[model samples]
Every structure is written in C-alpha cells, then in structure tokens.
Target: MMPSDAPPPLPEDLFAAARQARTNAYAPYSRFKVGAAVRTADGRLFAGANMENAAYPQGQCAEANALGAMVSAVGGQRIIEVAVVGGREDDPQDLCTPCGGCRQRLREFGTETLLIHICGPDGRRHTTTLGVLLPLSFGPDNLDIV
Candidate 1:
C-alpha cells in the first residue's frame, strides 16, 4: 500500500524518474528530450522518455513509452497519476506537458487520471485531468460495431 504521506513522489523524484528515462532514450535526432512517469493503480511507478529518430514520424512520445512500460510491468492495471517533464539537463528546472496524442492515449487508458506538469526550479506544478487534456475525446465508448 502506498504511504498516506508519500508526498506524491516529490518533484525531484519525478525529475529523477524522467531523467532516468531520458538517459535510455534513443534520440538520434531532434534533441527535444521528454520524459514521463506513471503511477499504477496498485501504486507501482513506471517511467519513460522520448525516443526520436531521423525519420521524424518514427519517433515515440514520452507518454507512449511510459504507458508501454507500465503495461509491461503491471500487466493490466489502470494508471492513477502521471507526470511528464523535459529538459536539456536532468534539472527539474525545465519541463513541459504531454502532447495531444499522448493526452488521447492517457484518456483511453484512464480518462479521469491526474496529469501533472511541472516546470521551473521551484517545481511549480500544473494539475489537470485527461478529460481536459482531450476535450471530446474518443474512446472505447465512442466505438460501436456489431
């Protein structure tokens, strides 16, 4: 069980996870590094970072990589919370939010999941929901085939 006062994985912790993922990233082009951390419903944490390619379209988003890691690690479990960050250095000073495709992916797995975006040295955080991230989102509910 997660500790009651687990402090929601401090900004530094999140940054560490992101940075770790960043290190494993296979970015051969577009040095725009991104990272993601996902918390499983059972409280397991998984992290992933952006992997760019010379082909551009072949690149993978940080969120997608994180989701893949989470799925592979936890089997089938809902994601509770997710944090995404990016920077040239592993500093928690420069971060950004997930892109549109990432948001949609989040909504598909957990529509109500908490998405946190942190930036700056002070670890200023912006909290939002997948619903807000993907307004009028498409999901399993939207697809019907008989």
Candidate 2:
C-alpha cells in the first residue's frame, strides 16, 4: 500500500476523467457543464458531473458531487488533488474555477496545500491550492461540537 502521506500523483488520466465526466453533466438550465475528479491521499479516484435544478439554489456542483462520492467511500477523507473542467457547452475554454461554496466544501476535506487543477478540454490550464482559493476559511475543525 502507498504511504498514507504520499503526494498525490498528477496523471493526465485524471484530467481525462474530468473531461469525460463533463460530457455527462445535467446543465440544461445554464448550458454550463462542469466536471470534477478528485484523488485522495490513498490513491483513489472519483469523478462527478454538475447537475442543475430549475430551482437554481438546489443545483449541485460537480465538485460537490465528486467530494460526496469520496466521502461516501470506505475510508480516507483527505483529498490531495482535484481536477475540474467547465465551460459553456459550445465553447469549453473558460478557466472554470470552483465556486466559493465548493471551495469551502473542498476545504472541509482537504488541507490548505491541496492542489486544485483547473482544466479545459485541451488539458490543464492552471493549478492552485486550497489555501490560495479559500484563504483563512472555516472548516470542520472550526466546530466545537464534541
């Protein structure tokens, strides 16, 4: 088994998985498709596609879906790396970063150093860390619940 703290592997296939998941997005309302794939410290991969709802606020982001999948898995909660791809269906080129809510959600399960790989159909365009995306944020640890 790989070490518990090993750095996440940056494989091109991770981006490929996100891109492929983008094709399955249910974004009929905004026509904006987003896909997200996350790699845990344990070397597991999970992918998710954005789903929209007419109610708008009820819509689920791709990142949330991916994170949900990871959380529902057997073990491991630390996401070492994430790949996200999103854009208008006709032209998928915008450097679609995770929204503020998703960023906070990510921070709940990832360290400040967790890598967020922003991708387009062509491939990765930028890479940022959770600290850079959501600086001085609140998380599970912030809760005082016993």
The candidate scoring highest on lDDT is 2
Candidate 1's C-alpha runs over 4 A off are 1-12, 87-95, 120-122, 141-146
- In the range 6-74, model 1's lDDT, one tens digit per residue, is 334444666567666766767667767677787776777789878887788988998899999878876
User: For model 2, how does the per-residue alpha-carbon lDDT over 57-112 read when each residue is reduced to its tens digit?
Assistant: 99999999998888787444778889998854344456899999999989878878
Against the true structure, whose TM-score is highest? 2
**Reference-based lDDT, each prediction:** 0.67, 0.83
TM-score of each: 0.74, 0.84
Superposed model 2: Cα runs more than 4 Å off = 1-10, 88-93, 143-146
